[model samples]
Target: MGRPTPDYRRYRCTIGGEVYTVHLNPRHGRRLLDLAIATGSELVWATTWEQYANDWIAPRIGLPSLPVIPLTSDPPSEHGEMFKTPHVAAYAGRRPFVWFDDQVWAEDEEYLRVRQGLADFLLIHVDPMRGLTSRHLGMAHEWLTLTGFSQGS
Candidate 1:
């Protein structure tokens, strides 16, 4: 959900089509919150994990409860945008926003570019296997700085 553990140890396995195991931790959450504070960015849960992210993942990562993008069903995929793409764009509305997700695709980027109009947007794709890293955070921070989205700016 948020950061990896101190050693960044995590285990994931798929025992069957219906059964799986996953692990989570907190160090990254603190870094993320710090970044949010510095940038004046509001962090919201945009994962398929939904409210479950707030329930199960946030606490372990030391994050307070966050707003969730209500995703009850997938929007039509006529444009090949991922299921979350339309929902994310709608939730963002007219606000400039940066989104981090493992499933983001080029189609999603194009969709957002047109959908957001003049609103600034950034989408960073996280590698599911490696999870979030300092490099990802650095990129996000750098993007914020370049876009003049930080508090000091």
Candidate 2:
């Protein structure tokens, strides 16, 4: 399967907003969490580092905490792959959601597998070179529609 929008299939820009300067790294976890919270989407992670990122990790970077869900390593029978996001997403449950990680595209199989089971999906990427665009804004808007995140609510 493809993306919600074919144009946005592979990092295609269409958000039509000012591109913000961002530093690409795992440190932006908090900003991602804030985005998830603002959108009212449940934050899901494939590992513990991602789960409490806001509570313990982002705070050091000066970001706030958020509701997060962490998934455990799949059984050895499942060919344990920590970075395997489809399993991680399945662990997240069927909800209006947004997930982070360098693994967003990596979870295409998972996203496709569960598309019908979901109410909504908001995929975000923070690119230092690209900043934010209409698609990004659209994604955030979609996230907000699926979730309920507002500024400091």
Candidate 3:
């Protein structure tokens, strides 16, 4: 069966006459927690701009407070490279990890391809409109199972 899409709402926040719409998918949040439980995965929070992930995001999503990766002052690359990539890599060190974000693209893949000493890395880019889905979780579970990283492996 295909993955199910989560229910979401868009809330508009106005700041100094500028408006921004934030998408909130509570179902996706639950799915993320379920995925972590199913895969024996460690979910660490990392974001470039959201300072209230622990305070605001986690509570809304039914997640516990997680370790947040600190951001650096790296500028964006011409190919739209993510500024948080290096910080994530450094934080991961030689450990295997799975990254879920809406911003990763080709440039980010290229950046990861050349990094050495990483055991195994899976970068899943969720569609901002759709949020995280069951398919993504299934893929992560399969990867962990194949790599002998699943729970009780």
Give the winner by lDDT.
Answer: 1
Clashing pairs in 2: 14-135, 15-133, 15-134, 15-135, 16-134, 38-149, 39-148, 39-149, 40-148, 40-149
Off by over 4 Å in 2: 1-38, 42-56, 65-68, 75-87, 106-116, 125-138, 146-153
What is the Å distance of residue 142 in model 1 from its true position? 1.0
Candidate 1, number of clashes:
0
- 17-83 per-residue lDDT for model 2 (tens digits): 6332223234345555565555555544344445444544445444556554555564542322234
Encode model 3's per-residue lDDT on 1-153: one tens digit a residue.
Answer: 233344656556554576666666766567777777887878888885345577656766677888889897877665556888888888888767788888887677677766544558888898866677778888887887787777888
Better of 2 and 3 by lDDT: 3
- lDDT-better candidate, 1 vs 2: 1
List runs of model 1 lying over 4 Å from the truth: 1-6, 9-20, 115-119
Model 1 has an lDDT value of 0.78
Better of 1 and 2 by TM-score: 1
lDDT of each residue in 1-153, candidate 1, tens digit only: 354446554544333344345555468689889989988888999877788778767877789999999886865788777888878888878777788898988888887786545358888998776688888889888888788888977
The alpha-carbon lDDT assigned to residue 125 of candidate 1 equals 94
What would the TM-score be for candidate 3 when compared with the true structure? 0.80
Find the candidate with the highest TM-score and give its number: 1
Off by over 4 Å in 3: 1-6, 12-20, 78-80, 117-119
